[model samples]
Target: MKNITFADAQNLKNPIFIDIRSPREYAEDHIEGAINLPLFSDQEREIIGKIYKYEGVSQAKLAGLNFLSPKLPRLVKEILAYKEKGDIVVYCWRGGLRSLVFTEILRLVDIYVYRLEGGYKSYRQEVVRFFETAKTLFPVVLYGMTGVGKTLILKKLAEKGLPVLNLEQLASHRGSVFGHLGLLPQPSQKRFESMLYDVLKELKGFPFLVEGESRKIGKLFLPKELFQRMQEAPVILLELPEEQRIKNLLRDYQVDKIDIKYFLESLQSITVYLGRAKVESLSEDLKKGRFYEFTKTLLREYYDPLYKKSTAYLRNIKKVISGNDIDELVAGISEYWGEFTGRDLK
Candidate 1:
């Protein structure tokens, strides 16, 4: 079994990362592309832990062997399938007995593989270090009121091969009160950072387009250094007519497909700002299927006021592009970026 650092493993050509940890651990976070092939199930790992705590390390080792022995053939077969695709690299929570034993078993079967040194923990440390020290990132932050197509425009710019760091996508939250609506559960904070690191590492030392966001996106917070940089970076404010803004939000949120009970609950969350009476009225409008009116009232009475107040401190406005056409807006942004940086943003 060869030991490899996470950095070296990443450099491997088409490496297939096999996570040899429990399913629960892998579910929380693992190497981004790693597949989970558990050495023991979650309950089995817990059982071994109890043995180690009460019956000593020897008992725990015996228990672990009993749990793993039956699964070896299947696990090896699954890993061998992946090996045909690329070089196999295995990891557990740490470079501990699980990975070591798994790699040894593979060796016995003549299936050589690299074991990740210090496993997931080491990779996580690298992610933390990257966020703390990365200083050369040039962010062209897209600033706009809600429903002005900031995320949509960033996606378009990315399709055109411009570097784009989509924070919302990484966080799995839209950076708003309703950001979690119709989306999967947000990843753990560590998982979010891992995803963010994967994107930022590639865009290091280059200007990347990202939607402007507050420090927190749903339950996840942006890295302190990165958020500070965004606050200080040049901004391009996007605008759309109020009617179009409402339409855009309606389509984006898919109000027709939303659960009414959940929608009402989300509306109540901002009652302190919108007042109980206004929220009740909005909820009624939603229940009545007056989506356009519900959206318009929320924008004018809640979102717009908040957006104006939050952006009041930003004095570094580089340009303001207004339109309902996505393609036109993208072209306008590309033109401004070229003019501002004196380099084509193709």
Candidate 2:
């Protein structure tokens, strides 16, 4: 019966958020760091929902109780383990039956439990609003074609404690046609925003560095405000030779390890833009394992051409940094950043 509003949940010390939603729902999205403690399995949830829709709430409640009765003892045992760790915050899709029932069970054992006031939906609103209206953030966006190790360099920057957010990593896609190769399916938009919020919260102040990205990184759209900030921020182009870029691509993409079908499908996406003849040529190269050659063509005929159009009006290319040496590139980024913010990255 205890309730903690999403806003107040932020101030709780050592809070452990327990998501009692179905597995499918939890997979779609939940509060960050939440542990999935489903009161009903995915199939069990669907059956209950159908009963509620056709039979009515009274019958639905009866069916839900049937499912909970057998699981109650184990659920309490699992919850009791978290006692004394911190305030335990339990929630369901909409602060409904599952979480409340679970909380009531725990309360009987004299264990204090708090439920999220409006469940995951309310928490999602706060996540969206935080991104849409975050404080004025200064972003220094690093720009490069498909390669030039921008993501790798972003990792280096983060390693050195620079405020850096890896959008592609958050989306679980690399932000290219081939971005999804060998990676998990892109997260739901809600899930993407939640992870993005987690990353942004860590670096709330100062000039944070983000890789140059389009409005959509795979299936996830960068929050409107953050994307706009990137477009308007200073850009440091990491220029590299076509050959070197191709080499970098091969190393990072591991094209040989990827399915030829996936690679061809990736090329298929740009057939409209690259034209059928070039697309066929690229596919042929992929089949023959001439990854380096295919990469060069992609950069020149597909990636670079599109990149040019994307940056055509971005006159804010404040500095051009290029080299195979990561240290050199890191130095270039650090120097440009200090110049823009007038503060050294300590």
- Index of the highest-lDDT prediction: 1
RMSD of each: 2.1, 2.3
Query: Which candidate number has the best TM-score?
Result: 1
**In model 1, which range of ten residues has the least summed lDDT?**
337-346
- In candidate 2, which residue ranges exceed 4 Å CA deviation? 343-346
lDDT (10s digit) by residue, model 1, range 1-346 = 8999988988999988999899999989888888989989999999999999999999999999999999998998898899899989999988988899899989998999999999889988998898888576678888888888777788889888888998887787777788889888899988888888888888757788899999899999988988888888888888778887887888888999988788888888999998999999999999999989999999999999999898643697878898776677899988777677676432
What is the per-residue lDDT of model 2 for residues 1-346, given as tens digits with 9 covering 90 to 100? 5999987877888889999988999999989999898888999989999999999999999998999889888888888888667889999988877788788878887888899998998898788888777546677788887887888889998888778888887888888888989888888998998998887776756778888888988878988988887788877888777777788788888988888898898788888998899899888998998888888888888788888787542698878888766667887887766677785523
The collision pairs in model 2 are none
The residue-level lDDT of candidate 1 at 100 comes to 92
In candidate 1, stretches whose alpha carbon ends up further than 4 angstroms from where it belongs are 341-346
lDDT of each: 0.87, 0.84
